[model samples]
Target: MKFERLPFIMKNLIRYQATMKENDWNKGFDLLRSIEFQEGVYKTGPMFFSMEPAENEPRYRNFEFFMPVNFQVEGE
Candidate 1:
C-alpha cells in the first residue's frame, strides 16, 4: 500500500448530510454530482465523506459528504 500526506486548505464546500441505512453511501455522491452539474460549479479537489452511528437510530448511520469547490455554494 502507498500513503501520502495532504495539507489542509480552507475552501468552499458543497455538503450533504443524512441519516441513512447502512451501505447507502453512493447516493450522497450522486446527489452532490447532480448539484455540481446543475450549478455549473468547478470542482477544485477530491470529494470527502465521513460516517458515524446515527444519534437516535442504531440501525442507521449519519453520513456527511463534502465536495470541495472553487466557488462558494449559496445554500445549505
Candidate 2:
C-alpha cells in the first residue's frame, strides 16, 4: 500500500484503555461502568468501539474504548 493512499480512508477505530480508581475497588468499578458511551447517538456523532478482552487487577478496573477518528498524515 502506498503511504499517500492513507488519507483516502475517512475514519478509523482508535483503541483506548484506562485503569481508573478513586480509592476503593467498588468505586472504580462503578466509575468505569458509569461512563456514557453514547455511540454518537446524541450529539457526539458516530463511534465504533472494540470489544477486546482485558485482564482485571486486584483493586482497579480496566476500561476499553475504540473511538472513530479521521485519517491523518504525517508531516502533511
Candidate 3:
C-alpha cells in the first residue's frame, strides 16, 4: 500500500489520504463534500506529484479531477 500525508484542515490537525478507482469521479467528490472538511490553499491548477523519472514507474499524463481537502479538526 502507498502512504502519504494529506493536507490538514488547519494547522496541527488530523489528516487522511485516500484514493478511489474513479469509476464515478463525482461520487468521490460528493463523499468529500458530505464530510466535515475544508478546502486547502494551493495554486489554482494541476499540482503534480513529481519526482525523478524511473524506468519502472508510469507517468500521469492526464487527470480529470485533482483536488486537495482537509478534514475539520477541533484540536491539534
Cα error, candidate 2, residue 18 (Å): 1.5
lDDT of 1 by residue, 1-76 (tens): 9998999775898889988987888999989988888898878899989999988899999999999987988995
lDDT winner, 1 or 2: 1
Among these predictions, the greatest TM-score belongs to 1
Give per-residue CA lDDT, model 3, range 14-65, as digits (tens): 3323333324334534543444334443322332221233344354122233
Clashing pairs in 3: none
Model 2 lDDT vs. the true structure?
0.39
Error of 1 at 28 (Å): 0.5
Which lDDT value does model 3 have at 62?
A: 21
Q: Candidate 2 — worst ten consecutive residues by lDDT sum? A: 35-44
Off-target runs (Cα >4 Å) in candidate 2 are 1-11, 22-59, 72-76
| Pairs in clash, predicted candidate 2 | 40-45
The Cα local distance difference test for each model comes to: 0.88, 0.39, 0.36
For model 1 the local lDDT of residue 6 reads 100
How many pairs of residues collide in each model?
A: 0, 1, 0
